[model samples]
Target: MLTDRTDTRAKLWRTASVQRGYFTAAQAKDAGYSYQAQRYHTQHGNWLQVDRAIYRFREFVDLPAEGDEQLVRWSLWSKGRAAVSHATALTMHDLGTASPSRIHMTVPRNFRQQTDALILHRAELTEGDVEERVGYRVTTPLRALVECAAVGEDQNALDIAIAKALSQGLVTQPKLLYAAQQVGPRAELGVERALAAAS
Candidate 1:
C-alpha cells in the first residue's frame, strides 16, 4: 500500500514527467510539498533549484528530447500563458532547419517576463492559432508561418516551413488558404507569397 508520502511523490512525478522535470513552487505545494520540504529536497540533491520558485528533479533532466527544454522552461516561467512561436514554432513543428538565436514567444497582453534569451510578443491567441506540446503550447503552423512573414523573419524560412508542412501532409493548401484569410491582408499576401514559393 502506498503511504501518503508515496502518493504525493507519484502525483508530482506525473506533473514533472510532462514538463521535462521542471515544476514551480505552486506546483510543489499542490503536490503536498511544503516550502521547507522543497528546500530540503534541493539541499539533498533530489531537486535542483532553477530560478526563483522553479525546480528540476535531478533524475528527470536526462529524460527530454533536444530543443524542447527551453520552450518548456519559458512557458513555465510565463505560468503557461506563452506559446512558442514565429520561427521557433516553425522549428517546433519540424518544418525548418532554423536554430534561432532567441526563443520567440507570444503571450497574452497582460503577461510580462523580461529576459535576454526571450523575444516576447503580446497577443491573445485564439484556440486555432495554437497547438499543444507535451508540457506547453506552440503556435500552429499557419500562425507561425504568417507571424514570421509579418515580422519579416526570413523569406526562405517561411518558404521551407510551408513546403515541408504541405509535403508531410501536416497541412493542406485549403487549410493554409483558410488560415491566410483569417489573418487579413498583409499576412494574406505574405502567406500567398510563401505558398507561391513553395509551389
Candidate 2:
C-alpha cells in the first residue's frame, strides 16, 4: 500500500538531491508523489520550479553559478539532444580566451528547447565528433572547432582552434584538411594554413 510516509519523503529528498537540484513531474510521480504533493512541495519552499516540468532545490537554484546547470539544462533540453560547441567547446579544450556568456549546444534542425540559456543550433555529427567529458557527452575539441569554423563569422577564432588542436596533437594535419573540406570554403584557408604549418 506504500504507506510508509517517512520513507517516501526521504526517498524524494534523495532523488531530488541526486539529480542535482532538478526534477520533473514525471519523476515525482514515479517516486510515489502525487502531482498535488509535488506542487505542495514547491509552494512550501522545499522545491523551486526552474522550468516547465523542471524543479530545483531552493537553496541552489542559481542557474549561472557554474557549468553544472548548463549541463543539466542541456540534458533536459530535447531529450539530451544537445552537445557542447563553439566557444564553450574551445573553453573545454583550453584552446581560446573567449568566455561565452551562454552555453553553446548543437541539436538537430527540428529539435527545440524552451530556454534562452543555451545557444542552440542545428547540425549533423558523426560518432567521431563526440567525446566524453565529466561523464557527459560533448563534441570533441577538433570536431567542435571545425563546427565553429564551418558556421561562425570569425575566421580568426577558427584559425586559433586549428592551431590549438595541432599544438596539442589532438588531430593530424590531414584530418583537419579533410574536415575543412567537409565544411567547405569557410574553413579551407584556415585548414590549409594549419596543415602547412603542421607539415
User: Best TM-score goes to which candidate?
Assistant: 1
Model 1 steric clash pairs = none
Which segments of model 1 are wrong by more than 4 Å?
1-3
Clashes within 3 Å, all models in order:
0, 0
> Which lDDT tens digits does candidate 1 get at residues 79-121?
9999999888888888867678888999999875687778998
**Model 2 lDDT tens row, 90-143:** 777887567778878888777855566678868876778887654245788777
Candidate 1 accuracy as TM-score: 0.88
Worst 10 residues of 2 by lDDT: 68-77
- State every prediction's TM-score relative to the real structure: 0.88, 0.79
The weakest ten consecutive residues by lDDT in model 1 span 61-70
After best superposition, candidate 1 residue 169: deviation in angstroms? 3.0
lDDT of 1 at 182: 75
